[model samples]
Target: MRILLTSALAMTLAAMAWHAQAADPERGRSLAGQCRTCHGLNGIAKIPIAPHLAGENRIYIETQLKAFRSGKRQHEMMSVIAKDLSDEEISHLAAWYESIEITATMPE
Candidate 1:
C-alpha cells in the first residue's frame, strides 16, 4: 500500500510539472499574430528600431525572453508582455519563429 501511494504521488507530481511545461506550436503560431503588428507578419522588422525574429537562434530567443520575464533586462513594453508567458510558451514561439525563412532587402 505504501509503495502504491508513493507511485501515485510521484505520478501526480510529474503530471503537474508537465502541465507547467505544456505548449502548442499551432497555438504559438496564432499567438504570434499579435506580434505581427510591430514586427510584421513574416517576422521581418520593417524599420531599424525593430529586430527580426525569423531564423533567429532558439537559445538566444529563450535567453532574451527569460531576461525580460525576470526583470534582468529592462524594457517597459517587452517586460510587461513577457512576464505572463510560461517557459513552454516561449519555447513554442521560439520554435515557430526559428522555422521562418530569413530575408531582408538592401537599403537605398
Candidate 2:
C-alpha cells in the first residue's frame, strides 16, 4: 500500500511538471512582437524574403529555432535573432505560430 501511494505521488508530480512546461500562447504572443517585422503579427510574411509562419507545426518550429540558435542551421538574420532566445522563449514562439489558424484553398 505504501509503495502504491509513493508511485501515485511520483506520477502526480511528473504530470504537474509536464503541464508546467507546456508552452504558453499568451506569453508567446507578447514575445512574438519582434517577429512581426518579418513574419507579421499574425504569422503571415510581410515581404517576399520572409516565409509565412502561421499554423506551422510546433515541433518543426522548435526544431528549426533550436538549430538556428545552436548554429546548426545557418541564416543571416535568424542566427542573430535566435542566438538571444532561451529554450522557453523558443517554445513560446512555437506555440504562438502553431496557435494561428490557416487553411489552404484549392484553385479551381
Candidate 3:
C-alpha cells in the first residue's frame, strides 16, 4: 500500500508540473502586442507581406517560430523578432493564435 501511495503521489506531482508548464493564452495575448503592426491582434494580417496567423495549428506556429529563432528559417523581420523569445513565450504565442477561430470561404 505504501508503494502504491508513493506512485500516486509521484503521478500527482508530475501532473502539477505539466500543468504549470502549459501554455498561457493571456500571457501570449499580452506578449503579442508588439506583433500588431503586421499581424493584427486578432491574428489577421494587417499588411500584404504578413500571413494571417489566426487559427494556425499550434505545433506549426511553434515550429516556425523556433526555426526563425534558430536561423533555420530566414526572414529578416521574423528572425529579429523571434531571437528574443524564450521557448515558453513561443508556446504561449502559439497557443493564443491557435485558440482563435477562422473560417475560409471560396472566392467567387
Q: Give the TM-score of candidate 1.
A: 0.68
Tens digit of lDDT per residue, candidate 1, span 22-68?
A: 64556668777767876666678766787998888766877898999
Candidate 3 per-residue lDDT over residues 6-72, each given as its tens digit: 9999999997578446988778899889888899988999999999999998879999999999999
TM-score of each: 0.68, 0.79, 0.78
lDDT of 2: 0.90
What would the per-residue lDDT of candidate 2 be over residues 66-94, giving only the tens digit for each residue? 99999999999999999999988988888
lDDT of each: 0.78, 0.90, 0.91
Local lDDT at 100 for model 1 = 82
